[model samples]
Target: MSAVELNPRPVRVSPLIKFTRWSLLGLGILYGAFHHNRFSKIENARREKEEAERPAREARLAAEKKRASEAEIKYLGELMTTNK
Candidate 1:
């Protein structure tokens, strides 16, 4: 076999295929960027809401604890008086 025939010829890709491949790549990148940005915004909003509610939730829990303690004390006092 001759040297020219020994080497494989380079494959030629069609312009339309190349264009479609690049377009798909570009659209994929754009979609990923948009979705990432949107996801970050949603995560930030959720974190902010959690931070905002934390204090209120703590205060409510403290109030409930206090009320329970008061009720227990009243019950104990009544029991002592009745026993006397």
Candidate 2:
């Protein structure tokens, strides 16, 4: 009986296949980074918008308070004048 020798050959990949694989990987990384940058920009814009609106909200509240005080003063003046 003759001893059989088994040698496994190394598989060769084509250059085009390797290039396509690397290109796909690069595109995936770029896509993820692009979305990450976009997300940060959106978060920053939201924060800025909130900051900008805060002063307007405070001003509106202040104006409302001033109007209420003016109305109360006018009523008191009218009552005093009528009683005189």
Best by lDDT: 1
Q: Could you give me the TM-score of model 2 versus the true structure?
A: 0.44
After TM-score superposition, what is the CA distance of residue 14 in candidate 1 from its true location, in Å?
0.8
Q: Show the lowest summed lDDT stretch of 10 residues, model 2.
A: 1-10
Q: Could you tally the backbone clashes for each prediction? A: 0, 0
Q: Report the Cα lDDT for candidate 2.
A: 0.96
Q: Alpha carbon lDDT of residue 22, candidate 2?
A: 100
For 3-83, candidate 1 gives per-residue lDDT tens digits of: 577768889999999999999999999999999999999999999999999999999999999999999999999999999
What TM-score do all the candidates reach, one by one?
Answer: 0.54, 0.44
Model 2, runs deviating above 4 Å: 1-9, 49-84
Q: Give the Cα-based TM-score of candidate 1 against the true structure.
A: 0.54
Q: For each candidate, what is the lDDT?
A: 0.98, 0.96
Error of 1 at 67 (Å): 13
- Alpha-carbon runs more than 4 Å astray in model 1: 1-9, 56-84
